[model samples]
Target: MHYVKAKGILSAKNGMNLYRGCSHGCIYCDSRSKCYHMEHEFEDIEIKENAIELLEIALKHKRKKCMIGTGAMTDPYIPLEMELGHIRKAMALVCEYGHGFTVITKSSRILRDIDLLKKINDTTKCVVQMTMTTYDEELCRKIEPNVSTTRERFEVLKELHGAGIPAVVWLSPILPFINDTEENILGILDYCARAEVYGVICFGMGLTLRDGNREYFYRQLDRSFPGMKEKYIRKYGDQYMIESPNSRKLMALFHEICRQNEMLHDNAQIFAYLNTFEEKYAGRQLSIFDL
Candidate 1:
C-alpha cells in the first residue's frame, strides 16, 4: 500500500472512496477496466491520506444532512482497512455530523464497525449494501477468493438485521455458463429472504466484461475452469454485456421471489432509498417550553 494526498474526498453526491485499487482478487471486477486509468497495479492499494480530514470538512459545511456513501469504486472494508481504520473514522465523522451512512461491500470485516453503524442508525440512517453472486461456497471461493464467502456474508446480513440496521443485497455480475443457473440464483435469493434484507439490486443475470477486465477474467477462467475461456470467446467475442443464456428465466424467478418476500427489487426505488436521508427526531426535538 502507498499513501498519496487527495485533492478532494467526497463526490458531488457525498460518496467517498478512502482507497484506490483493491486486493480482493475478484475475477470480474469492473474497476480493472482501463477507462478508470489507475497508474499502479490493482493490488497496490492507494490510500488517500487526507480523506478523513476532507470528509470532516465536507460534512461540517453541508447545509443539510444527507446520506454519505462509499464502496462505489472500491470496497471500504478491504483488509488494509483493519490497519488504517479510515472507514471507522469516516463513519465517526458521519455520525458526529448527523449524516446518514451507507456502504457497499463484500467483506465481513464490516462487522468490526457494527457499533458505529448502529450509533449512526440510532439517530439517522445506516444501510449496508452487500454483493452476493455465487451461492455455492466452493464456487464463491473460486471467484471471490480473497473475500468473505456467500455464507459468511449471509451471517453478516443477519447480524446487521439483528442490530436493527437495514441491509441491501447486490445480486449482480453473475458469470454466464458458470454461475448463471436456477439453483445459484435461488440459493442467493433465499439467503436474502432469510436475512430479511431491505432490497435486492439485480441489474440482470449476467456480468460485463471490457478490454482490461475481460482479459483478466478470461485469464482467471482459463486458470480455474480450463476451456471456459474458449467457450466465452466463441460465443461472446468482445461483447461488453455478457448476458446469460438463462437471463430471461432466471430474472423472472428473481422478480417473483423478491415480490413474494416483499423486498424492494426495483433498482431506482432502492437507489432512491439509499440516497434519501432521514433523522429519527426530525420534528421531535425537545424545546425549552417543554422543560
Candidate 2:
C-alpha cells in the first residue's frame, strides 16, 4: 500500500472511497477494467492520506445530512482494513456526527464495526450491502477468490439483521455458462430469505465484459476453468451487457421470490433507500453543561 494526499474526499453525491485499487481478487471486478484508468497494479492499494479530515470538513459544512456511501468503487473492508483500522475510524466519525451510512462489500470483516453501525442506525440509518453471486461455497471461493464465501456473507447478513441493521444483497455479475442456472439463483435467494435481508439487487442473470476486465477475466477463466474463454469469445465477441440466455426465466423467478418475500427488488427503489438519510439529532441544541 502507498499513501497520497487526496485533493477532495466526497463526491457530489456525498460518496467517498478512502482507498483506490483492491486486493480482494474478485475475478469479475469492474473496477479493474481499463476504463477506470488506474496507474498502479490492482493489488497495490492506494491510501488517501487526508480522507478523514476531508470528510470532517465536508460533513460540517453540509446543509443537510444524507447517506454517506462508501465501498462502491472498492470494498472498504479489504484485508488492509484489518491492519489499518481506517474504516472503523470513518464509522466512528459518521456515528459521532449523526450521519446515516451505507456500505457495499463482500467481506465478513465488516463485523468488526457492528457496534458503530448499530449506533448510527439506532438514531438514523445504516445499511450493510453485500454481494452474493454464487451460492455454492467452492464456486464462490474460485470467483471471489480472496473474499468471504457466500455462506460467510450470509452469516454476516443474519448477524446484521439481529443487530437491527438493514442489509441489501447484490446478486449480480452471474457469469454465463458457469453459474447462470436455476439452482444458483434459488440458493442465493434462500440465503437472503433466511438472513432476512431488506432487499436483493439483481440486474438479470449475467456479467459484463470490457477491455481491461474482460482480458483479465478471460485469463483467470483459462487458468481456473480451461477452455471457457474460447466459449465466451465465440459467443460474446465484444459485448458489454452479456446477459445470460436464462435471464427471462430466472428473472421471473427472481421477481416472484422477492415479491413473495417482501424484499425490495426494484433497482430504483433500493437506490433511493440507500441514498436517503434522516438526521437523528436535527434541531437539537447541546446544553452548555453537556458541551
Candidate 3:
C-alpha cells in the first residue's frame, strides 16, 4: 500500500472512494480494465492521505443531507481498512454530521463498524449492499477467493437486518457455463429471502469482459479451469457482454422469486432507495453543560 494526497473526496453525487486498487483477487474484477487507467498494479492499493479531512470539509459545507456512499470503485472494507481505519473515521464523520450512509461491499469486515452504521440508521438511513454471485461455497471461493464467502456474507446480511439496517444484494457477473445455473440463482435468492434484504439488484444472468479484464480472466481460467478460455474465445470472441445461454430462463426465475418474496428487483428502484436520504428526526444539539 502507498499513500497519496487527494485534492477532494466526494463525487458530484456524494460518493467517495478512500482507496484505489484492491487486493481481493477476484478473477473477473472490472476495475482492472485498462479503461480505468490505473498506473500501479491492481494489488498495490493506493491510499488517499487526506480523504477524511476532505470528507469533513465537504460534509460541513453541504446544504442538504443525503446518502454518502462508498465502496463503488473499491470496497471500503478491504483488509487494509483494518489497519488504516479510514472507513471507520469517514462513517463517524457522516454520523456526526447527521448524514445518511450506504456502502457496497463483499467483505464481512464491515461488521466491525456495525455500531456506527446502526447509529447513523437510527437517525437517518444506512444501507448495506453486498454482492452474492455464486451461492455454492466452493464455486464462490474459486471466483472470489480473497473475500468473504457467500454464506459469510449472508450471515452479515442477517446481522444487518437484526440491527434494523436494511441490506441489498447484488447478484451479478454470473459466469456463463460456470455458475449460471438454476440451482445457483435459486440458492442466492433463498439467502436474500432468508436475510430479509430490502432488494436484489441483478442485471440479468451474465458477466462483462473487456480488453484488460477479459485477458486476466482468461489467464485465471487457464490456471484454474483449463480449456475454459478456449471455449470463451470460440463463443464470445471479444464481445463485451458475455451473457449466459440460460439467461432467459434464469431471469424468469429471478423475477418470479423476487415477486413472491416482495423484494425490490428493479435496478432503478433500488438505486433510488440507495441514493435517497430520509432524515427521521431532529439531531440532538450539544449543550455547553454536556460538553
Candidate 4:
C-alpha cells in the first residue's frame, strides 16, 4: 500500500472511497476496467492520506444531513483497513456531523465497527450492504477467493439486523454457465430472507465483461473452470454485458421469491431507499425547557 494526498474526498453525490484499488481478487471486478483509469496495480491499494480530514470538512459544511456512502469502487473493510482504521475514523466523522452512513462490503471485517454502525443508526440511519455472488461455499471461495465466504457474510447480515441496523445485499455479477442456475439464485435469496435484509439488488442474471476485467476473468476461468474461457469468447465476443441465456427465467424467479418474502427486489426502488436518509430520532430528545 502507498499513501497519497487527495485533492478532495467526497464526491458530488456524497460518496467517497478512502482507498483505491482492492486486494479481494474477485475475477469479475469491474473496477479493473480501463475506463476507471487507475495508475497502480489493482492489489497495491492507494490510501487517500487526507480522506478523513476532507470528509470532516465536507460534513461540517453541508447544510443537509443526507447519507454518506463508501465502498463503491473498493470495499472499506479490506484487510488493510484493520491496520489503517480510515473507515472507522470516517464513520466517526459522519456520526459527529449527524449524517447517515452506508457501506457496501463483502468482508466480515465490518463487524469490528458494529457499535458505531448501531450508534449512527440509532440517530439517523446506517445501512450495511454486502455482495453475495455464489451460494455454494466452495464455489464462492473459487470466485471470491480473498473475501468472506457467503455464510460469513450472511452471519454479518444477521448480526446487523439483530443490532437494529438495516442491511441490503447486492446479488450481482452472476456468471453465465457458472452460478447462474435457479438453485444458486434461490439459495442466495433464501439467505437474504433469513437475514431479514431490507432489499436485494440484482441487475438480472449475468455479469459484465470489459477490456481489463474480461482478460483477467478469462485467465482465471482457464485456470479454474477449464475450457470456460473458450465458451465465453465464443458466446460473448467483445460484448460488455454478458447476460445469461436463462436470464429471463432466473430474473422471474428472483422477483417472485423476493415478492413472496416481502423484500424489495426492484433495483431502482432499492437505490432510492439507499440514497434517502431518514432522521429516525428527530425531536426525540427532551428540551432544556422540559427539564
Candidate 5:
C-alpha cells in the first residue's frame, strides 16, 4: 500500500474513489484495462491521502443535498479499508452534511459500518450495492479468491435489510462457458429474493474482455480451468463484449424472476433510485410555530 496527495476528490457526478488499484484478485476486473492507465501494479493499492478532506469541502459547499457514491473503479471496502478507516470517515462526513450515500462493494467488511449506514439512511438515504457473479462457492473462490464469497455477501444483504438499510445486487460479468448456466443464475437470484434486495442490476449474461483484463483473464483461465483459454480464443477472438449463447433465454428468465419477486429489474429505474436523494424527516419535523 502507498499514499499520494490527490488533486481533487469528487467527480462531476459526486462520486469519489478514495483508493486506486485493488487487492481483491478478481480475474475479470475491468479496472485492469489499459484505458484506465494505472502507473502502479494492481495489487499495490494507492491511497488518496486527502480524499476525506476534499470530500468534506465538497459536501460543505454544495447548494443542494445529493447522493454521494463510491466504488465505481475501486471497491471502498477493500482489505486496506480496515486499517485506514477512510470509508467510515467518509460516511461520517456524508451523514454530518445531511447528504445521501451509496457504495458498491463485494466485501462483507462493509458490515463494520452498519451503524453509520443506518444513521445516514434514517436522515436521508443510504444504499449498499454488492456484486454477485458466481453462486457456486467453489467457483466463487476460483474467480474472486480474495474477497467474501457469494453466500457471505448474502448474509450481509440480509443483515442490511434487517437494519432497515436498502440493498442492491449487481448480477454481472457472467463468464461464458464457465458460470453461465441456469443453475448458477437461479441460485444467485434466489439469494437476492431471500435477502429482499431493493433491486438487481444485470446488464446481460456475459462478461467483457479487453486488452489488459483479457490477457489477465486468459492467464487465470489457463491456470484454473485449463483449455478454457483456447476455447474463448477460438470462440471470441479480439471481441470486446463476450455475450453468452444463452443470453436471450437467461435474460428472459432473469426478468421473469425479478418480476415475480416484485424487485426492480429495469436498469434505468434502478439507477434513478440510487441517484435520487430523499429526506425522510423533511416535512415530519415539528417546528417552533407548530409547537
Candidate 6:
C-alpha cells in the first residue's frame, strides 16, 4: 500500500473514489483493464491521502444537495479501509452535511457503515448496491479471492433490507461458461428475492475482457480451471464482450425472476433510482408552539 496526495476528490457527477487501486483482487475487474492506464500493480492499493478534505470542500461549495456516489472504480470497503478508515471518514462528512449517499461494492465489510447509511437515508436517501455473480461459495472465493463470498454479500443485502435501507444487486460480468449457468443465476436470484432487493443490474449475460484484465483472467483460468484459457481464446480471441453461450436463456431467466420479484431489472431505471434523491425528511420541523 502507498499513499499519494490527490489533486481533487469529487468528480463533476459527485462521485469520488478514495482509492485508485484495490486489493479485492477480483479476477474480472474492469478497473484493471489496459484502457484504464493504471501503471501500478492492481493489488498495490493506492490511497488518496487528501480525499476526505477535498470531498469536504467540494460538498460545502455545492449549491444543492445530491447523492454522492463511490465504489465504482474501486471497492470502498477494501481491506485497507479497516486501517485507513477513509470510506468511514467520507461517509461521516456526507452525513454531517445532510447529503444523500450511495455506494456499489462487493465486500460484506460495508456492514460497518450500516448505521451511517440509515442516518443519511433518514435525512434524504442512501442506497447500497452490491454485486453478486457466483452462487457457489467456493467459486466466489476463487474469482473474487480476497473479498467476501457471495453468500456473505447476500447476508449483507438481507441486513440492509431489515434496516429499511433499500438495496440493489449487480448481477454482472457473468463470465460465460464459468458462472452463467441457470443454477448459478437462479440461486443468486433466490437470494435477491429473499433480500427484497429493490433492483438488480445486469447489463448482459457475459463478461468484458480487454488487455490487462484479459491476460490476468486467462492466466488464472489456466491455473485454476485448466483448458479454459484455450477455450476462451478460441471462442473469443481479442473480443471485448465474452458472452455466455447460454446468454439468451440465462437472460430470459434473469428477467422473469426479477419481474416476478418486482425488482428493477432495467439498467436505466435502477441508475435513476440510485441518483434520485427523495426528500423524505424535508418537511420535518421544530415543534414547540406553546407560547
Between candidates 3 and 5, which one is better according to TM-score? 5
* Model 2 per-residue lDDT tens digits across residues 154-255: 999999999989999999888989999989989999999999999999888898887898888998999899999999888888999888888999999999
The C-alpha lDDT values of all candidates are 0.94, 0.90, 0.93, 0.93, 0.95, 0.89
Q: For residues 1-291, could you state the per-residue lDDT of candidate 6 as single tens digits?
A: 888898999888889999888887788888988888888887898888889999999989889989999999999998889888999999999989878999999988999989999888887889999999899999988888999999999899999999999998899879977998999999999999999999899989999888888888888898779898998988999999888999999999999999898988999998998888666544442245522
Q: Give the clashing residue pairs of candidate 4, or none.
A: none
- RMSD of every candidate to native, in Å, equals 2.5, 3.8, 4.0, 2.6, 2.3, 3.1
Error of 5 at 108 (Å): 0.7
Off by over 4 Å in 6: 282-291
Query: Model 3: per-residue lDDT, tens digit, 21-134?
Result: 998989999988999888898899999999999999999999998999998889888899999999999999999998999999999999999999999998899999999989
Error of 6 at 153 (Å): 0.8
Better candidate number, 4 or 6, judged by lDDT: 4
User: Model 2, residue 129: what's the lDDT?
Assistant: 94
| TM-scores for every predicted model | 0.96, 0.95, 0.96, 0.96, 0.97, 0.95
Query: How many steric overlaps are in each model, in order?
Result: 0, 0, 0, 0, 0, 0
Per-residue lDDT of candidate 4, residues 166-284 (tens digit)? 99999998999999898999999999999999999998789888889888898899889999999988999989999999999999999999999999998899899999987754535
Off by over 4 Å in 4: 282-291
Clash pairs, model 2 backbone: none
Against the true structure, candidate 4 reaches a TM-score of: 0.96
The TM-score of candidate 2 is 0.95
- Write candidate 5's Cα lDDT for 1-291 as tens digits: 889999999999999999999999999999999999998999999999999999999999999999999999999999889999999999999999999999999999999999999999988899999999999999999999999999999999999999999999999889999999999989999999999999999999999988899999999999899999999999999999999999999999999999999999999999999999887665343356655
Error of 4 at 151 (Å): 0.6
Runs with alpha carbons beyond 4 Å of true place in candidate 2: 280-291
Point out where model 5 deviates above 4 Å: 282-291
